[model samples]
Target: MNRTNKLSVIGIAVFTGVAIMGDAMLSIVLPIYWSDMGLTAVWQVGVLLSINRFVRLPINPLVGFFYRHYSLRLGISIAMGLAIVSTFSYGIFSQFSILVMMRIVWGIAWSLLRLGGFLSIIQLTSKTDRGQFIGLYNGVWGIGSLIGMLVGGLLIAETSIRFITTLFGLIGCVTFPFVPFLTPSGKKEPTVQKTTTDQQKPLLALDQFVLTLSTSMVMGLLIFGVFSNTLSARIDQSYQDNWTFMSFAFTSTAIAGIIQAVRWGWAPFLAPFIGKYLDHTKHKQQALICFLLSLSALFALIGSINQISFVIVLLLLFQFVSTGFVTTTDTIASDLAEKGDSIKVITFHTIMVDTGAALGPLLAFGLLEYFPLRVVYLIASILLFVLAIGWISWLRKKQNDPFAFSVRK
Candidate 1:
């Protein structure tokens, strides 16, 4: 990458990191204050956590459409403005209804930020280094989430949730000046001449897009949606009264937050390696399958095992495997995006992500009312395992086709 592209990546990474910091802060803060915020039922937490994703689902396409016609930096600046408002509002309002409204607004902001970031990185990097760049973007920006979780936890323990939340909002506003450094949308470079075979397979491109979208949706369902909400609530419920380690000084929520931080912290160290491997391997499909299967197994183990130690280990494993799948799927999507269509392709992919994230917790929590936790996880495991198998079978069928689309390392 050139110095300009590097600068763009850094600027975008900072923007993404700050935006995610707000989200991570809420993930830690919201559950602890669910009842305190006038919410009576348990299901309400899932609803509140997921409603933003629901709002994001339909708005992503519009965000993409707008990117095609407008400046990316402008869109991102507007998004950052909304993020500041939404983060600040969380502290100002305790009412569930008002909180839900703020979440809706935050959803629109996230859609713009996410789409803008993906388009910017894709436009700035060459195909040869695309995976590494995307991985770097995710890895670097992910630190914001780690900081948010750690600092939010400490602040909640020392001062107040409202104070910490508002502080994060102000921190988000600090990214505004960096917006001008982002690469503009709809800017195109000269294309290399393609062989007749490469140019003849639009259907193959569509197929790859569908596969990548499906993988992204599953990632949303398992990683972003179900695990985050369910596990945090479980920890809070299990240990809220008097659970702790290290001489029983810390509350379970604090411990959980630390664990969550560690899980996120692993990404910056691991994503670059995963990206490089994907960029150099022909077995990308097999690697993805393995990651999915491993995640499915880990989910089942977590559900079946009740021991805290075992559960923690399983959760970490789940995080590791899920990270692999997420980076791989994103790299695939980036690979499949045709020139000048990054906005459209990324928007659709983001829609799938939002759809699954929106529905995962809502549906999982609803099922929890009727089923045991183990059964719920087992169902998720089975579903993902089936997807892995189906994907492998599809790969086998396409193995012999000369025009078949695959991510080449």
Candidate 2:
């Protein structure tokens, strides 16, 4: 990538990191501090947490439409503004209705930032290094997750919710001056252009998008949707909030926060390397299969293990598999988008990913109501194994036809 493109990618990643810290912190703080936030009902906590996602289900397509006509710079600016308002009010608002409205605003802000970020990468990066750049972008922005989970989760015990949310909101204000410098100013031109040979090749069957889009949804369902939402409870089941290290007592929530923080902390270095490998590898399908199978086994191992130390180690390894799952699956989506109408394809890809994420917790929680957590994880493992088997079939078919138009550029 050129210097300007590189700078833009880094700047937007930084901006997104800040924008997400407020949302990320809520995953850790909201349920525990609902009363502190003036919430009177327990069920209301789930509404507050999930309402943003429901709003995004309808808003992503609109944001995609917005990018087609408007500048990413403008979209990101508006998103940041909404994020600031919502995050700041998290500390100030006590009324449930007003809080829900702010959550809805945050939902819209997230859609803009997400689509805007991916659109920026699609605009700025060429095919040769697209994976690496997008991978790095994911890693850099994850710093906000690290901060949100680590600092915010740990600090809730020492400070007030209002203090934490307000502090994060103010930190977002510091990035206002840098927004325009990072995002592209003009509307997006078409990024997909088939080569002469590619033009001659028949397009991949099933709309050329179904495979990757479906895969993206499943991975998101497992990683962002299920694992993230249920991590604290999983730790609690294993450690019972009594695990200690080096004479320091740790609550399950604290342990869960630290574990998630550790993942994000390593993501900046780890995700980029994974992306760079995917960029260079010629056998991308094989790589995807390996990632899926690895995840399947890890899920099984996590479900069966009862030793807290071993489970923590297994969970950490599961994190590695998950990071690879998301990076690999998303890079496939980006690659596929580059082969067609970039915005429309990516918009659908985003929706599918959001769908998986949205459904994961509901499904997991509902199942948890009847089955053990191990049963839930094993079910996920079985789904992943089936996905891997399906991909193996796809690889064989692709080998039989050299000219079949696959999603990759």
Candidate 3:
């Protein structure tokens, strides 16, 4: 990538990273503080948490269609405005209905930001270096989530949700000036294939797209959706109040935030290395399977453990595994998108992410209503392991038939 394109990537990543602070903080905050926030039922927390992602299901494709005519600047401006307003509303509103409305607005804003970000990054880079840049973008943008959760979790004890959210919203306004300079021109690069590699053609194949989309969806569901929503709550279940670790005081909320924060804190460095590994590896498929399988084992182990000392360690370990999966899965999706129609493929990618994310809280909370947290983790572990096996089987089948993917132009 040229210096200009590289700057564009960094700009979009920072802008997006900043914009995500409010939403990311709320993952732990809302679940932990449902009663304090004027919620009457625990389930309402899940609903509020997920509603934005649910709305993104419809909103993402529309953003894709909108991009055919509009520029990233316009979409970004509208998105930033909405992000500010909605972030403020999280602090300002007590009524469930009003909060729901703001979350929907946020969903739309995120669609614009997310779809726009994906386009900018994909358009700005090529296959060889795509993984690293995607990793870099994800890493850079994740800093906002880190700070949002880390600081918000720390402050929520002393400050109100309104205070934290409103402050983050105000902070988002600072990124507005960089939008134009950072955004891509939304032009398509000519589809280039260095070789007649199967990676290019099969990405659009019915089975391949489904597998990739499924992997994307499941990762979102597990990491983005389930783990984040449940992190605090799952820990809190061991005690009615605070959890003590290492002779230092810890609330489940604080600990959850810290765990997530640490993950994203290292993301700027580790994520790119993971992406670089994918770039250099000859066996990307096997790497992805290993990530999936690792997560499955980690989930079961974390869920099964009752010891305070081990639980935190496992939880932190799980975050590292989740990061690897998230980086790998997203890189895979971007590769698929780069090979096909950028707009359409990316929209599909975003929808799957939104779907998993949307379902995450609802499923996590709802399942907790009847099942133990262990059961939930067990179920997710089984699902992941099954998915991994499916991938292995798919790859083997594809290998047996060299023409599994069409070579036609």
Candidate 4:
């Protein structure tokens, strides 16, 4: 990479790290904060953490729409500015309702940043490098959470919420100035013509748009419902006597990240071999991915039972497999996207994924409330099975004319 590319990469990494730190604090620390504030209801804690995603649902599509019109630089800068303002205000207000409002604003900011930053970063790289670049991108977010949790835990022990919030504010302040350097300089896309005309072409296909949208939404449900919420709840309930299940889950996730990084480090070399087999196999890549996803669902079901400590350890292994599998799916999706639309595809995917993640808790809560944890896990597993079957059926129907993927071109 040249100087400009290096600068862009660094800028993205720094911004991503800082922004994720705030989100990390919320995820890893806010439950304890709610406890301290006497908001002990599981439902209330779920709302406090999840309201942001509900707010983000509306905001994400709009960010996608705007990116179709404006420069990524402008959209992302605006989003970062909002994050900076919101981070500052978070500490100023102590009221639960007010904090919820701030979290909503923060969600909007996150939508913009996530969509714009992901797209922009994709645009900055070439087809050959996208997987590796995305791997790095994904790794940074995990690293950010790891760092933030470590920092937040210490701050809560030794200092105050105000101090911690201020630290995040300082991080935002430091990151703002570097945004300009992140802008892509190598490519100049055609500016939109101002001439009035009928029959304007849509920037993305309807099928492409809808499928990617579904993919994003499902991703959110997978994260919030199954991966994070339901799994945690099941494990927590299983070891109610110990109070260490959640801690172990967190430790497992952190370890999963490290394991994922090690795996991702070899993805570039490994992908070619995998790709060769995928290309030759009768099963399409998309269909095979769906299979892996089904396996993930199966693992979720197994983990949700909370059989024993040994079983939980086995579940953690499954969790690592799921993470690695998702990473691979993302690489495949990015590879298959239409030309010049990598960013939009990714943004749409993020929106769906986050939507699922946000709803995961509420879904889990509902399931757990209405039925046994095992039943809830069974239903989730069924859902994943349906997703796989549905997607595979679609692919089979369209097999004669494969999805017009950029890589195939």
Name the candidate that leads on TM-score.
2
Model 2 lDDT at residue 386: 91
lDDT of 1 by residue, 1-409 (tens): 7988877877887787887676777776667766656777777776777788888888998988788778777888888888888878877887778888888888998898888888787778776677777777888888988988778766876887678777888788776776875656453322333567657866555566677788888888877778776776555443535554777676555566667777678887788788878877777788888988998898888888766666777777777888788888888777666453666778878888888887778778888899876787898899789888867766754665544636333
lDDT of each: 0.76, 0.85, 0.82, 0.60
* Reference-based TM-score of each model: 0.87, 0.94, 0.87, 0.76
lDDT for residue 290 in candidate 3, whole number 0-100: 91
Off by over 4 Å in 1: 34-47, 94-98, 182-203, 233-246, 249-255, 401-409
C-alpha RMSD by candidate, in order: 3.6, 2.5, 3.9, 6.1
Which residue pairs overlap in candidate 1's backbone?
A: none
- Using lDDT as the measure, name the better of candidate 1 and candidate 4: 1
Question: Could you give the candidate ranking by lDDT, starting with the highest?
Answer: 2, 3, 1, 4
Tell me how candidate 3 scores on lDDT.
0.82
Write the residue-wise lDDT of candidate 4 on 169-201 in tens digits.
Answer: 788888888777686533223232232321242
lDDT of 2 by residue, 1-409 (tens): 8999999999999999999999889877888888988899999999988899888889999999998889999999999999999999999989999999999999999899988899889889876787788889999999997888677777999998889999999989999789998889987765667677656545444424667877878976898888888888888888954667899889887777778888898888898888888888766667788888998998888888887888899889989878877888878888777777888888888888888888999999999999999998999999889988777666556556644424332
Clashes per prediction? Answer: 0, 0, 1, 12
Stretches of candidate 2 off by over 4 Å are: 191-208, 245-247, 401-409
Locate the minimum summed-lDDT window of 10 residues in model 4. Answer: 190-199
